[model samples]
Target: MYKHLVVAVDGSATSLNALQHACSLAEMSNAKITLVHVANPSEYMAMAPEFMHHASYEEAAVAQGNEVLDFAEKAVQEAGLSDVVKHLLVANKGARDMAQELVDYADEQGAELLVLGTHGRSGLMHLLMGSFAETVMRQSHLPLLVIRSQKDEDE
Candidate 1:
């Protein structure tokens, strides 16, 4: 029933799974796919010492983000999805607001579904890093399908 689908990727296996799932759903429903990769340079810039090169750090992050998107798009195309779109966004740094940006972009694009994967972090790791999927679920109105990471499922 969904016509527009948004899938977020970050060059992680979990995200790769999400992309594959999105591709299958899109193919089945004849929906369009939008692959989004967000580059938040602020975290890197802030953490680097003043002596380190800032421009190179930001450039590397953007390049990596684009690579992630490229890989995701390739996988989708191989899955027989034709109407696929890609977006590489530079989000505000340090706020851990990628969730809000993804939600906003999906809404702006009139996406019917937002698909992503959770690393299933817990304990200290969860407390320190937080969870993007949880944030998006709490803030977005669009339907979400969050796939657990294979590692998590195995455990």
Candidate 2:
């Protein structure tokens, strides 16, 4: 049984599904769930080329972190996960990747399990943007539960 379940939510349907999965697993194991949202620095850099500007992508990411954390907290509450905590991870500061940041967070929090949602993007989309779910799987040392979209699972 997992003592601590770590869940990453990105505001996608797949992320929501992952949240649900985490809640279920927590309920089953009688464990605590920690919800995290990684604010991708690359995403912000891509959005605004002026990386030094205070109003640039970097600053935006820090602020967005709170928003994503709030969403995750709402999700946990809505899922009726009583023993859950929401965590906001700011990954823009010297972090290699969003996934790496999440893995470190889990370690810092002493979480035993990691859960993620897959977008199932392939080809150009996947090549250009990269995949958070894949990154998490590769970097995490703990047990991982990846929930793909319904259509992808069906296929």
Please count the clashing residue pairs in each candidate, in the order shown. Answer: 0, 0
Worst 10 residues of 1 by lDDT: 46-55
TM-score quality measure for candidate 2: 0.81
Across residues 45-80, which tens digit of lDDT does each residue of candidate 2 receive?
655455454565657776777677788787777877
Tens-digit per-residue lDDT, 96-135, candidate 1: 5788899999999999999998898899988998888888
Which pairs clash inside model 2? none
lDDT at 24, model 1: 84
Best candidate (score: lDDT) = 1
Candidate 2 weakest ten by summed lDDT: 46-55
TM-score of each: 0.88, 0.81
User: In angstroms, how far off is 76's CA in candidate 1?
Assistant: 0.4
